[model samples]
Target: MGTITALGLLLLICMVVVGGTQGLQAWISLIFNFAALFFAMVLMAFHLSPVLVTLVTGVIVLAMTIFLGGNDSNSTMVAFYASVAVLILLVILIIPIEHWAQIQGFGQEDSEDLEGMSTILGISYLNVAVSTAILSTLGAIAEAAIAIAAGLAEILEQHPKITLKNLQGAGFKVGSQIIGTTFNTLFFGFFGGFLALFIWFAGVHYSLGEILNDKILVGEVLMVLFSMMSVIATIPLTTWAMVASERQARKKFVK
Candidate 1:
């Protein structure tokens, strides 16, 4: 509870410093994110379309970005469109890579955690494992999109006269930085979040090769790399979109 409060306050401070316009939008975005998650869980509980639930949640996410994330409605719209493009590309890339890696569901070793969960819910542990694996990756995609949009916006603001090529180069540079930190963040987050499981592996003296080949481990690695690559890809795409939008706006004013 204390940690939550600290984070809330930290977000508030960050928003205030950034700009009231953006801050208000961010707060709204956060609220909508929670609402979407709640709705998604409700849908899941009712055994409704998991795909539909995900789609609805995704729409809500896009709406949140458009309504609460950007400086203007037009900018938000552009951001939303660009974000979708990046997400689609990322999905296309992740789908094949995940298959090539031969990763599925959780590691064979998470059975202990499954015991407590299985007792509470009569669902198959393997299904739950797969669901969780997919769920974990969703946040990465969302985060990368948001970061890409925000970075492009800042770059445009700072260099309104920047040529398209230069803008793209700047985006690549900014994206590289984002990728480095985000990848490390995801990597360490996975490491810290799954420390207990790793300890279990070590305790049981699982071979290093066995641990490396584990499905769960492979999934985590893929999620991190997928997100990293997606952000890298989004950078230039977003920069181009920003340039196009700005040029159109200027043209409108000139006319």
Candidate 2:
């Protein structure tokens, strides 16, 4: 069997064993997430604006990861809105920061990798850099939003009479618990993802300064920082969104 097929079958088996029907839905949503990303790349290749592609992909991925990941409508809506709000704010911050950082385009070290590519492709590497930052951080932002929303929702469900002030406190407490592991997840995930690249740097006798100043390295580090910031922003925003949503629901039910 092909490697991808084998992996898919394994995922199916594991999901069935772990969560049964819910796991199946999760798997389907995961598949849709990959499809959405693939579609976004194809669109980018066809000269579509990378910013638009990133925005659309973010929406699609958020929908699949929240709605199809077995979340209720309320939770999904909270996740979606919170994520979008945080992403917009992050994008605004990323624009000036990325420009100031001056890490766009290929570095001299990367010239070896782009030997024959024509500059006539007309692609704006700066825009591409911004898009890459957005896309890279998006998954973490979505995950953090969904997690915070779901946690707050559960807290509300368990303590239906909790006041907004108390709920916000509880949300912060819950967020504190999640933040540590979430940050570690991002940290270790980066380490694992770039382990081979790090090895290559060491193999090539790259100096510390060279490694630090490398364009790809700087870009990736910036992406990680951006993702971390998004995840941090997501916690409070999601909590506030859930609290606001709950308040609205309560006011409506009283009428």
TM-scores for all predictions: 0.73, 0.92
Candidate 2 displacement at residue 194 in angstroms = 1.4
* Best candidate, lDDT: 2
Output the lDDT of residue 23, model 1: 85
For model 2, the run of ten residues with the poorest summed lDDT? 63-72
Task: Write the residue-wise lDDT of candidate 1 on 62-146 in tens digits.
Answer: 6575556555455566667766676666555655565577675445676766765634543443433334444455556556555
Give the alpha carbon lDDT tens digit for every residue of 62-173 in model 2: 7777777645789779888998999889889988988888788777767777898876767777877888888788779888888888888888889899999999898788
Candidate 1, residue 7: the lDDT equals 92
lDDT of model 2 at position 32: 85
